[model samples]
Target: MDSPVDNANAIVRRHRLSTRLWHWLNALLLYTLFTSGLGIFNAHPRLYWGQYGANFDHAWLELDRFPGWLTLPGHYSLALSRHWHLAAAPVFAFALLFYMLWSLTNRHIARDLAFRRDELAPRHVWQDIRNHARLRFPTGEAALHYNVLQKASYIGVIFVALPLIILTGLTMSPGMNAASPWLVDLFGGRQSARSIHFLTAFALVAFFLVHILMVLLAGPVNELRSMITGRYRLPKPRSRAVP
Candidate 1:
């Protein structure tokens, strides 16, 4: 076993090349998709739940158009927005698919992201939550692994949010509806899928904000270095006080 002193000083491989690649790529891709998506939404700020929706159709949720500053082109151009969104969407979806396959083959998912049986226990999860609330972070060897909360969020984004957003995006496509009618049926209808897509996109944005906050709280330099270079210095353990 490595000594604590040595462990604290050791520089270790924290992220895989694939993980870093996808992380940066998504940083760009998601930004484009999101901004452009907001622009597209500006054309119709209302959300509905049936096959058809338009100016006169009743909507389940409605909102004032997102501001120009918050959208792609920084102006109202649905054509340009759709162009940006369409171009980026395929790349983002395919990259996620490839990353999923690669992670599976590399056992990154099983080894890192998979939840342990013990981790799923209510007491264990509650403890993790409490620790996070208190801003307690792992140290030394434990810092090399994700806590339960981290694991859960990563798994949720990878498995649930990303795929659902992709399918919902496809469901909104008239061409896709012709090709895969089941996609629309899966989510109920085009409008329903659109609503889900909108909600899921915001969910991802929420995750990203929380993720950034965690990185900043944990130590931005170390966190950013690990993601960028795949090398991380283990955080030194807190010393026990003499009793």
Candidate 2:
């Protein structure tokens, strides 16, 4: 397709239809999983390693139960929380798989998320960090491209964090353990898998918070409109003097 009105700084297509669909779907599913998972955790707010963890065991970490507002059902009920989590888990996993395949076929992963060699250089990476610290956001054409930091974070969340969480989650399940012993062995044991799952879940929560901050920092209206409508108005080009 031809470039949309460069001189006028037109509302160019920013996100693809598949991207928009997956983004909203993921938001809803993740919210459900997070809240319900919290409710489940309220039953046992402790983490341990190895094969077994009980009240008698020395938990590496222990905490009070999450507040009612932060959990699903707004009450302590492990069984109900498990029901909500189990129902959402398969759907979330399948949606991620579908999104990954679709992104690959569309070249979205390769073209947008892949890191270029130059971007990995220490000097370049530091410069991007400094720019972000200074709130020196990209404009015009530059805004359309994913910077090294953006690419790295997106790649980490999608390829590494999401997959790890899903696999570790399955490893903690008795049925999954029975059906695929190797999966359990891969994570060392059920207790270890449980610890990893809890950690990964919070890591995703951190990412979500930062993602929201960036959206607000970079103009939520523009960022959100781009995601929802697939169109983004290009910021005016920054003037520069050539030596």
Candidate 3:
């Protein structure tokens, strides 16, 4: 049997160097994209469906002017905001593409993020949700793997949300529309794509907020250290009573 000290000192590699690099880089790019996107949204705070929209058109969703503090550069500069947003777009897009390719080639997505068949059952999902609601986290060997909910959330963000956001963004680009009119048609029109992009941006923001909250709940030090050094110290397993 291992000594307590040995067990305490024991560490497991939880993340790869490339994964860590991409994670942090993506975090930075996302923050830039979100904030600057807000700045751009401030230029036109209304969302409309179909092809065209203007000051006189009927908008489906409209909001009061966003304060300076809520926007990038802390001021109204549509031109500057567009520059920041557009510049970050390609870098962000490429980073996501590289990460996806790496994940696929390494089988990380399949091994880690994919839900097992059993995990898809309603009972299992409900149990996981209950555990999470109770603030009960995995321990020991169980902590080595992500929970079903985590897997689902990660997969959704990686395979669905990010791709949708990227494509909708491309659809909104005039040059892209010129190059591929089919892209615009796929989304119904430029305005629809713009609305989708705005909604998806908020979805990402919601994910980020919940991610930070979970980290704090799960132990920020361990979470941060794992991402930084790829070493994670598993929690002690819960004891079971004999039947």
Q: Give the TM-score of each candidate.
A: 0.96, 0.94, 0.92
Total clashing pairs in model 1: 0
Q: Which stretches of candidate 1 lie over 4 Å from their true place?
A: 1-3
Q: Please name the candidate that would achieve the greatest lDDT relative to the true structure.
A: 1
Which of 1 and 3 is ahead in lDDT? 1
- lDDT for 39 in candidate 2 is 98
TM-score quality measure for candidate 2: 0.94
Q: Which structure is stronger by TM-score: 1 or 3?
A: 1
Q: At residue 205, what lDDT does model 2 achieve?
A: 97
| Residue ranges of candidate 2 with Cα displaced over 4 Å | 1-8, 238-243
Whole-model lDDT per candidate: 0.92, 0.90, 0.87
Lowest summed lDDT window (length 10), candidate 1? 1-10
CA RMSD of each candidate after superposition: 1.9, 3.1, 3.1
**Cα shift from native, residue 211, model 1 (Å):** 0.6
- Residue clash pairs of candidate 3: none
TM-score of 3: 0.92
